[model samples]
Target: MILALSFIESPIAVIVILGSILVFALYYFNKKQVILRKLSKTRRKAVASLKTNEFVKVHGKALHVVAPLVAPLSKRKCVFYTIKLEKKVSSGKSSYWKTIVDEEKMQDFFLEQNGSYVIVRPVPSPKNYKSYLVKDEKVSSGVFNDPTPEFKELLKTYNIDSEGFFGFNKTLRYEEGIIEVGEKITVAGIAKWKTLNEPIPEYAYSKIVELISDEKEKLIITDHPKALKDSRHSI
Candidate 1:
């Protein structure tokens, strides 16, 4: 007991512990802001001014190039969507939510601004990179309240049983986010121009550019108001 107390009382040990906690707190609170700052540093470019293989950023209304995807939980028409499912677990005197599923889907969309448009090709995320998605909608269900029919169907599609072995509903939460049609969005990536085999509506150029991600630069897309504000300020 005396030795343990001495260890705890040691100035070096106290300083090390406090420093570690401070580092963790800084990282936990500022991680997203750091990403936002990096995004803001990329200068916004006009669709007509984009150069081949140049890194660029753009903000405009999202328009679907093809059939829009239906958000699984909300059933909203969107070009991109992310869904998360978590289960509540208890141990000893403490309980925590454990993530059971995480999935995202996206398709090519057009960013229209000032009578011009550019295609945005969302690249498949590499193992080292994660796409930042905003999940604004959330729902929870537990023993007192059962999941809705639609929720049960979603769980079934994931092959996750909504009930325990004893036929009791398990505590679960669902979160979803989507980039709906006509929503303003910002995107940053490497730009490449390609020749169109056929012309599309609302664009007069014979060649159009598409924003894509590469090994050095990962594509970033967000609808967060703060991020959007920062982006505009950067411009």
Candidate 2:
């Protein structure tokens, strides 16, 4: 208690701690700005005009070449989905939402534009590329309210109990985002042409092209063109 009071009483110590936090916040903000600038500066291109090894951005309706995934919380069919679980944590006189679980999944999908289809591979390579998704669905449960059976099951899978030690419901929030089939979305990546071994529906071309992230560039598959503005769910 003496040490805690001394640390709080010392102006220099408090200033140094606050300054460190400010510096960290600024650094993080700048890093995200750099990524946003890169995305904003890239010019959007037509699917037919994309060249192999070229970096391009394309916007079109999402088309699933394969079976779509069911979003965990909403059960909606989508090419990509991200779920975040946060619990409220209280300290002294302040409370903050602390993230307990963050999960995201994606599959290959097609981007159709003007009768031309380009495959989009959202899986990041070993080069540390990233995908930014904007979650549009959210749900919350707390002491006065209880989660549904499905929500409790999900929490069980993560080994998190829905109730606290006294059997009261814990304050929790869930956010889910998905890129549904036929949803208009934007993608940016390095384009490459690949020869198809078999034919596929809606596309007659024997040789198909795909957008993927490479060592030099990261693939961006987003439901919103302005996803950088709301990137909290980025994965």
TM-scores of all candidate predictions against the true structure: 0.82, 0.78
The prediction achieving the highest TM-score against the true structure is: 1
Q: Candidate 2 on 87-198: residue-level lDDT in tens?
A: 9999999999999998888888888888888888775444334555667887788999899887887788899999999999999999988898889887878889999988
Q: Rate the local accuracy (lDDT) of all candidates.
A: 0.81, 0.80
Which whole-number lDDT from 0 to 100 does residue 84 have in model 2? 95
Clashes of each: 0, 0
- Which ranges of candidate 1 are over 4 A from the true structure? 1-31, 125-130, 230-235
What's model 1's overall lDDT?
A: 0.81
Off by over 4 Å in 2: 1-35, 124-128, 148-150, 227-235
User: Which 10-residue span in candidate 1 carries the lowest summed lDDT?
Assistant: 123-132
